[model samples]
Structure formats: structure tokens, C-alpha cells
Target: MPATLLIPLYRDEVAPRFDLAGEALLVHLDADGAELSRSSVLLAHASSEELCRIALEEKVRVVICNGIDDEFWQYLRWKRIEVIDNVMGPVDEAIARFRADALRPGDILFHRSDA
Candidate 1:
């Protein structure tokens, strides 16, 4: 079986706040964790309600994002959507981690600068 995942995007990285995300990436993966399809969805506006509606409409199984409100989180959970919140990094790295079943809440995938 295949499953769908959603990631709120800010340029090439994961959006810092779910309620403020203006775009999202939808990915479909096979039972073996191989990607079946990926597409970007541009929101009409940045709104948690809108995002929630989109998630339901798209039948998203998972969501990767940061700074989600507890109300929204609980709602998604109640609706059976798996949310991995507080992630910070490039979208590609996050997706790779997810595909490998290593992505978790509060993960920071960005490299630190020594400077």
C-alpha cells in the first residue's frame, strides 16, 4: 500500500510555523518507502484551517512541520494524521530521513556553523 505525506515548505526548507506556511509539498510513497510522486501545493493563503482542510482533502497520512499549535496537533491526531513537528532543515534532508524511518519530532537536520 502507498501512503501520502505532507510537508509545509518555506523556500527549500521546512516552514518554521505551520500556521504561516504558504506552500506545501505532497509526496506519495510505496509500501517499500519508495517515492511514487511528489508535488507542490500553493495555498491561497497562510492559515492553519486551510492547511488542515487540504490535508484532509489530500488524504495525507503524515505531516512534517514546525511550531504547530497544540489545538491543531490534537485535531490532526484525532483525525489520524501523523504529525512530526518541530523539525528544522532543508526539505530534501527531512524527506530522506522520513523515507528511512528516522525522522522524529524536534529533529534539527541543519549543519551548525563553527563561526
Candidate 2:
């Protein structure tokens, strides 16, 4: 079966911090790089515990988020969920890079104001 990815969202972009996000996006992608579906979930609040619960409940295989707490990061990894952390970009671009096997930890696909 194809894998599912969970991404915390902030205004159509990857949330800057996982624990601070109040919204989430779940993406289902097939092995052939086709997007099966995409949906947004409004979180009850910004809580890592709640987020982890959803991930587990949804059987998410991968998580793409920006900043994440060390403890929570370790916890997800321990649960066998692959986390691609520190990804700063629009949701579509991020997923594209992931599908191409080009996305990496700390990937910044959005325009950098510092440039």
C-alpha cells in the first residue's frame, strides 16, 4: 500500500514549529508519485501528544514538519514513523521534492528573505 504523510500547516506553508501548529494536513501518495488524496484537520490545540495520537490513528508512515521538539521527534522515530524535519516550503513543493527523493532534513524550498 502507498504511504501517508502528515504535515503541520500554517497559512498554506509548513508550520514553523510542530508543537505550535493548530492545523494539520494529511497527504496520501501512491508509490508511483501520484497523490491519492489530501485533507486538512483542525487540531484541538497545539499539542504534540494530540498530534502523535492522530498520526498513529491515521497510520501515517512519514511526517513532514518544520521545527520539532527533540523528545517528540525521538518518540515518533521510535514508533517507526519517518520524520523529515525542518522542511520550510509550500506544501506542494515539499511533497514534490519528497516524491522525487530529493527532499532532505532541513530542506528549504520556499524563497528565503535573507537572499
Candidate 3:
């Protein structure tokens, strides 16, 4: 099946904390792992439960964020969503690494945005 990746977003970068993010980037990757579409969603509020609900509602298959709480992490995993946490960088770069299968938890791909 094709997979959808959700990334908690803060401004132009990955949100530092998942539960605190008020917006998210939803990326749909085709069966071949090419991007099918990308959308940004603004939430009514930020919370772990809200994030989970949105993910489930959107049928997201993967989640990539900078930091996530343990309970939320476990919950997402339990729901069968692949969670790649602690990744820090510009949203585009992170997604690039993800598509290339080079993204890992705690990876800081971009050191500066002004470069």
C-alpha cells in the first residue's frame, strides 16, 4: 500500500515537540516512494491526543518529528504508524532524507537555515 508521512511542523522546520505543534505537513508517498502530494494543516489546538486523532483520520502511515513523548510514541506505534522521532532540520531536507531512507532518530541534517 502507498504510505503517508506526517511531520509535525513549527514555522519552516520540524516542531521541537510533537504535542506542542499547532500545524503539520502531510506527505503522501506513492508505492514507489515518490511524493504524490504535500499539504499543510492547521489544527485547532496542539496536544498528543489531537495529533493522534488527526493522524488516524488522515490514514497516516508514518510520523517524523523532532521530539515526542513516550506515551504518544508508544500510542502511535501501537496504532501501526511508523514513528521517526528526534529528527531536526528544515522540513524539505528532512523529507528528502526520509525519502532517501537515510533519516534516523536524532539526526540533525541542517545546522543552519541562513546558510
Candidate 4:
């Protein structure tokens, strides 16, 4: 069966904090990891509880975000939802890394230029 993934968004990048995220990107992937569909979810407000509820309601198999509180992290883990936290980058880059199985906790995918 295909799997579903969620990534909280802040503009075009991953949200810096999961609890404060007001939008999310939902992606569906097939067994071989090819993207099946993608969509954006706009939340009425920023709330960890609401995000978690959405994850559950959508049957999300994985969540990728920048920072997440231990409470919510543990809750998702307890519910068997895989979380790849501490990821910082453009949503497209993060999704590509995830699809390639290269995304990991604490990954910083942003490019830095020396001034």
C-alpha cells in the first residue's frame, strides 16, 4: 500500500517549529517511493493538537518537520507515526531527500553563502 507523509510549512521552507506551523504539505507515495499526489493544507490556526489530529485523520505514515516538542513527538511515536524531526530546508529539497531515504533527524539542508 502507498504511504502518506506530512511536512509542516513556513512559506516555502519547513516550519522552524512544528507547534507554530499554520500550513502543511501532504504527499502520497507509492511503494517504490514515487510521488502519487501532493497537496497543501492550510490550518485555521497554529496548534500542535490540531496538527496531530490532522495527521491521524489523514492516516499519515510519516512527518517531517524542523523542531517538535518532546510531548508531541512522543505522542506521534506512540501512535506509530514515524517522525523525521530537526529537518531544515526548502520543502522540495526535504521531500526529495526523504524520497531518496537520505533525510535524517537534525539534517540542515539549507545552503549557506559566505558574505
What would you estimate as the lDDT of candidate 1?
A: 0.94
Alpha-carbon RMSD of each model: 1.1, 1.3, 2.1, 1.2
Cα error, residue 96 of model 1, in Å, equals 0.2
**Model 1 agreement with the true structure over 1-115: per-residue lDDT tens digits:** 6789999999999999999999999999999999999999999889899889989999999999988999999999999999999999999999999999999999999989972
lDDT by candidate, in order shown? 0.94, 0.93, 0.91, 0.95
- Candidate 3 lDDT over residue span 1-115, tens digit each: 6889899999999999998999999999998889999999898988878889989999999999988999999999999999999998899999899888898989987777686
TM-score of 3: 0.93
Q: Write the per-residue lDDT of candidate 4 for residues 2-108, one digit (tens) a residue.
A: 78999999999999999999999999999999999999999999989989999999999999999999999999999999999999999999999999999999998
* Residue pairs with clashing backbones, model 3: none
Pairing residues by index, what is the TM-score of model 2?
Answer: 0.94
Ten-residue stretch with the least lDDT total in model 1: 106-115
Q: Which stretches of candidate 1 lie over 4 Å from their true place?
A: none
Candidate 2, residues 8-114, lDDT tens digits: the string is 99998999999999999999989886899999999878888888999999999999999999999999999999999999999889989988889899998988788
lDDT of 1 at 108: 95
Candidate 3 lDDT (Cα, 0 to 1): 0.91
Clashes of 1: 0
TM-score of each: 0.96, 0.94, 0.93, 0.96
Residue pairs in collision within model 1? none
